[model samples]
Target chain A: MGRRSWVGAGLGAALVGAVGVGLLVAPAGASAAPPLPPVSPEDLVSSVMTAQRGPFAGEVEVDNALGLPAVPGVPQLADGTSTVRVWSGGEDRGRVAIPSPDGERTLVSDGTTRWAYDSRDRTATRAPAGDHGGPPEGQQQDPTAAATQAIATLRQTSTVAVDGTAEVAGRAVYQLVLTPQPTERTLLREVRVAVDAETRQPLQLTVLAQGQGEPALRVGFSEITYGPQDPSLFTFTPPPGTTVRDAPARDGEQRPEGDRPRSTVGDGWDTVVIGQAPQPGDGRPRDGQDGQDQRPEGAPDLSALGQPVSGPWGSGRVITTAVATVIVTDDGRIAAGAVPQQVLTEALAR
Target chain B: MTTVSASAPPASRASTRSVAPLGRLAAAEIRWVLRRPRTLVLLGLLALVPIALGVGIALTGGPGDGDGPGLVAAVAGNGLVLPIAALGLALSLLLPLTVATAAADALAGEAAHGTLRGLLLAPVGRVRLVVMKAAGVLTVAVLAVLVVAVVGVLTGLVVVGGPSGTMITLSGTTLGLGEALGRVALVAGWTIVQLLAIAAVALAVSAFTEHPLVVLAAVLGGLIVFGVLAAVPSLEWLQPLLLTSGWTAGADALRDPLPLDGLASSTGRALVYVVLGAAVTVWQMRRRDG
Candidate 1:
């Protein structure tokens, strides 16, 4: 065949594909998500859960639009885009750096010793392996971190669906949409995940909240490179003259620092974590629980702390602040979240 | 006479071929920028911010945690942070305004002073004027920031006298004195890059007007508008497009796993502005009566 005719056949196929895309591009104001394929919802979640995660390093754009007021910790969880760089050789050894206006904070796991360093604070903490929460030893989680965590955490609460094929980071992906079931009573409306077509690992996660027109949060790699990263990034030696604190604890034991906050309730997307408040009646932190409980001699008086409020759920007093809203129900249960006060009241009922 | 290939090997060859002409143009531009008293005064004012900060902190005992983001806050702990603080303050508005005024003045100042005819009257290509003027403004900016960094270090040492070897990074990783210094250079370079977008805007605005003050005010107004728009939550989607949004985000270089995404996007955003702005500036200048 002549070169022109040979090109004609290729051009014909591209024309057909272009027509198909014209049919597929949803009308403006519809949604960024395309219509769904015939795949089963159960299969979609399992496919995402089992996605292959090879050793890789890349930078991800974290755009948070949750509109939550700045909480005391995790202050940057608001309407803005920040950058996070992650390097993981499998899961046993990983490094993630999240930079703020001041400086960056890095959490590095070198197989045996896991280090968490806050450069702004000039403090480095080294703890034994499996000391605190992190990836299980050698689990493969390349980029679907939010997806994987979401799948496991929201499996019981969300109605999963296969939302069809789309492109993310310029690669073909299958969109898995998860909507929280009504009983979940979560502020979140829907979560759309883009899973890599080849590796099946999630490439991007978009979260939409109730009454919000835009994605509340999106965590995805704008750029990525797969392969082993430099081994030196996994190993860290605190710069000379740094204040190094070793947090060596045997398996299942808490760190030497006493009274670290813990959630009495289990963990999940809608999990209500009630930190151990000062002893209910005694007006002091529970210092006697551990020898290292270093509470100051005079704890702040908690009497008449919560302001009064009432609703269909019940009557309660809430301590409202810029960061968080805490509801101290007359029944003695405490609920808190970065969410609005109504969400917190609903959680109390749940 | 010919478009040059950007490949490393070919670029080197092309540079060697045009070295004499380009070198003379660059020398003339650099000399023009350096000889300006206003440029010297601008740099002098920037250098004084850190000294005033250091001395004030020294008088007040030291910085408190309540202090906002800057090297001044870090000065209490490590004098090395002075450069960081100085650069931080400059990156937001000061550096860009400085660069914008200088860049605007390059072409507009000449026109205002009635030197446009003399400059164009020479045997210089219009494109070469744009290139030379841009080069001149950038040199001044680079020198200005370097002064801020050096003066900051000197004043920090004199005032705080804290051990300056360690750098507190955002990612809990400690940067040695050497690496920290290297990062300061990277940050300063990135700030120049971010400022070029403003300069490009100034350059383009300068083309439309002959009065240097009008050009300066127009560029500064553009910056203020972008900052205000970025602050509005309703316009948050346009933040990435705003050169002002990520101007100082390059502070990420100090972090362990550098936020290449932020740094790259910030640079990429600035590049887009520079390309479009420079294009208009050149095109407009090429069409001018001079």
Candidate 2:
């Protein structure tokens, strides 16, 4: 009996120890980078631009360190890690589903018609494709779209390099780094794009601000699978009893009275977009269904945030985050960008 | 206890009883556990929570217009979310607490009553006794979760879904009646696994102490500590080892084209705890003498 008990005790101890060891080692193995052949930065950039985007589906995770306070009417760029699923069937067909605790917000486009549905409110908005606004602001979620846009805007004003080969979403990728030129006045230090080695598609985009150790923003695929997705995934019909609304034709023929026209000042990394905060219930497209955005009365008090400041641009508040800053003027003209206070003042002065 | 020894014809026959059939032992143990007054009361109380939640939302017009948790706020019009949300809320503490109570009673309560000595002296071997105790705890966990889920769905359908049983998914798609029930069942099954892991740990703790309250305190206290550790961002390296870290992953069932990463990882973590807890209980039982 003594020997049998001893054997039983030993086996139990061994099994528990094995679990601890396995947990520790599994992460280290998943993150270890595999060896790959070197490629030039120029060649990698060209390859990304020319690569054909075929059918594929994946889950993308966004990590935001922007430190922006929750403001009414402003899209809350997720404060922590949020996951969204993306599917692309080449050309104009695509779908992105953003699932929240209460319900999901899904945007689907099948080449010609686009549908935006919010399950929380049971509302669906249908619009013809090719609207100038694209998904309301801050809804362009696919990593490939974000990466390509960053390259197009910053390539001429920055130095590009291929730092090394790394793995993203379990796929080998070339790390393409873009650093703003010495003459450029911007808060951003560099942007890194991870391009899949075999497919030449961008799988992740990381943006870093000056002096910050952590990336200011990271939009990347957490898990991805290449090849054909269910064709039915890209189509949408509002479930019965949904309050369906047809989006008024926004063909640049007429601007709604509540629409606050926006204009940009300066160029490249320091550009500031200025626009008036639209009135409550102005029917300006809402990209999210957060509680803060649903207030039936007066706009979310912008006065509750940031320190008050007066400049030649006029008296207002300047709200700052890790990656961007916004100044809401007393007269309601708001200017925002990734530039410093001095640059914003200069742009406002102009 | 006296009848077992009285029935033994000879000393050699006692050796044969040591190898008790596992099925019979489990059946007897589960019956004993279910008959306990405390277990019945705890499960009955659990059934009331979802009904209260559903009625409150129906009368109050849904948690004061969405200031509440998303799932609770969504319960106004969508009846299917009621069961999932109730489980999610209960999973944090109440469900684990209920399972812990049964596990504590499995060995500690019996030992405190002096009945454990009779079972220990009986022909049942130490390993088989430990297995039977674990089975009793398992039965309690399964019944506690099913009672909550079943009551929640009935309350939800009656209060919110009404005659048009159609409900929307988090992905903005609608579900048929069959599909909605399937999702609720999936959530219930996943919750059972999590509760089982918690029960296994409570049983191990139960074996070490004669006072049932100590087992309850130790298991619940450890869970609270795991919650504190998981909240600290710098302690992320230690989060993976905590049993509470994956409790919220059960919400994955509510998603359309469900993402299994969180749910799968959480299940794997719970399985590890289950094995470790069972092993410790077996090892402790072998050393214990009547």
Candidate 3:
């Protein structure tokens, strides 16, 4: 081999080696915390809650370590990292797009009208913007919304403290940690919100379960651009041929007659939402089910998921995720919360 | 080198006059590759995959009540996604195989045919020869992706988009024709870059072996190994180095408002492969005895 051959080999080796080092170095570089003035936890919480949200767009990534089975139809409930593209023009104008492997589910709100479209089913649900569609799912929940809601709901029940300052999505942030009080019965150990130091916006939210080294669930902005977003982003119209259904004025809560009313059983941090699991062949038309009966073919069997447990409350299957547990009683009651099995059972017993 | 110089004067003068320019050489290489019956057959066969996929989806009336996992299952009459979905499917194996085959034929096939010695004996520098061959490989990659994309898009628009030619994006928003085509172009362009990276690897392997089959085997085998490594959780540290790591990142082009992060990282990775592979090819060519 000539000297030129050696040189070329060296150059090739050097270039290829750089790629590996770069991948390793890039992530480590982001870990260096940016310096910022310290703020008390109470002030950080209040500022986050009262912050005037400016128009912005960002891609949020949710990492779920909930150990949930990947159900056939409801991919949102699967345990994995999912990305959501969100744009907000203001409080009342917003859009959220969650891209699956082959399809997307988009929800858009434009002050007066709200549209939720699923490309897989080709169905679009239109509703009044003011109608509460309930809290967004874990994957679709933005850090700002989830953090603020947690702070507002769990502040009194938890001990709040400023752990330190860190950088999230290149923004300096204060780490506000909320730990449940000693008497509080909950599965979650602490809820950490990364509040932007300058703008006071919550850039990241992480929830850890008891004794877990890693966060059970984390929702954070991987990339964010703050400015007046494109107004068109907040508006949506179902494409021609899409099945457009008008959601009832009450957020699609028109349940079949004689169904037990849904209720919450506990306070913040351990609240169990108890409801009736739709019975097989129930006449109720479920959301996004395409009018299929309950337990549609290929839908995951709930009994196959966690260990079976029976108690004074009656026999049921208890499925446990990293941060929450769900008990489906044989009698058709479903109770779920971020509490231990005992809390769920007690909720069911009540 | 001494013999050639001693016999230089008239031979060199006549040969120099007759020798084609670099551009002509590259054009000839590309034409030769495109004219090959095997290449044409492969491309014609590749074009059928999308048509088959689209027709199958249309016949089945798109996704069934059951949840099926596939690009076809997610089409739901959104014609714009069909081409992208087709490109995505082909990228996994078919397109890469095509690019690798062309790259193998570029160097190893020529060497096996004894034409490579004539090329080396010519006055064209070793680097120029490598560049010409790389251009040939690139041409094959571009044509392979274009055939799939154009055919798929046409099928999608006519069969699924209906006569309106309207496109619904993966973001669930309707897209204008111009913008939708631009998105498809973006996907097609990104896919070409990925295949270029694969071609570079094949060429590098081809440079070392006289048998084209060896080049094809090495490239495809390496890809399979890379795929396995990417799936292993513990080998995640090796992911960034694997050329196959972010192959799916091209789908991000179909997203609304467009995300460049995934595409950027994957492009950077592919560029690295191109540079490294080209370097290796040049080095081996430099050391080879004419």
Model no. 1, DockQ? 0.19
User: After superposing candidate 1, which stretches have Cα over 4 Å from the reference?
Assistant: A1-54, A60-67, A131-161, A167-213, A216-224, A246-313, A317-328, A334-350, B1-33, B44-62, B66-84, B117-132, B149-168, B174-182, B283-290
Please rank every candidate by lDDT, starting with the best: 3, 2, 1
Q: Pick the winner on DockQ between candidates 2 and 3.
A: 3
Q: lDDT by residue for model 1 over B25-49, one digit each (tens)?
A: 8788889787888888888888887
Worst 10-residue lDDT window, candidate 2 chain A: A135-144
TM-score of each candidate structure, all chains considered together: 0.68, 0.83, 0.83
True contacts kept of each: 0.30, 0.38, 0.41
**Per-residue lDDT over A147-184 for candidate 2, one digit per residue giving the tens place of the 0 to 100 score:** 55655666777887888888999999999898888777
Please count the clashing residue pairs in each candidate, in the order shown.
11, 0, 0
- Off-target runs (Cα >4 Å) in candidate 2 are A1-43, A71-76, A132-156, A248-267, A271-300, A309-316, A328-335, A346-350, B1-15, B50-68, B73-81, B153-167, B222-239
Order of the predicted models by TM-score, top scorer first: 3, 2, 1
DockQ of each: 0.19, 0.38, 0.42
Per-residue lDDT, model 3, residue A251, is 25
**iRMS of candidate 1, Å:** 10.1
**Pairs of colliding residues, candidate 2:** none
The alpha-carbon deviation from the true structure for residue B242 of candidate 3, after best TM-score superposition, in angstroms, is 3.9
Error (Å) of candidate 1 at residue B45 is 4.2
Interface RMSD of each: 10.1, 3.4, 2.9
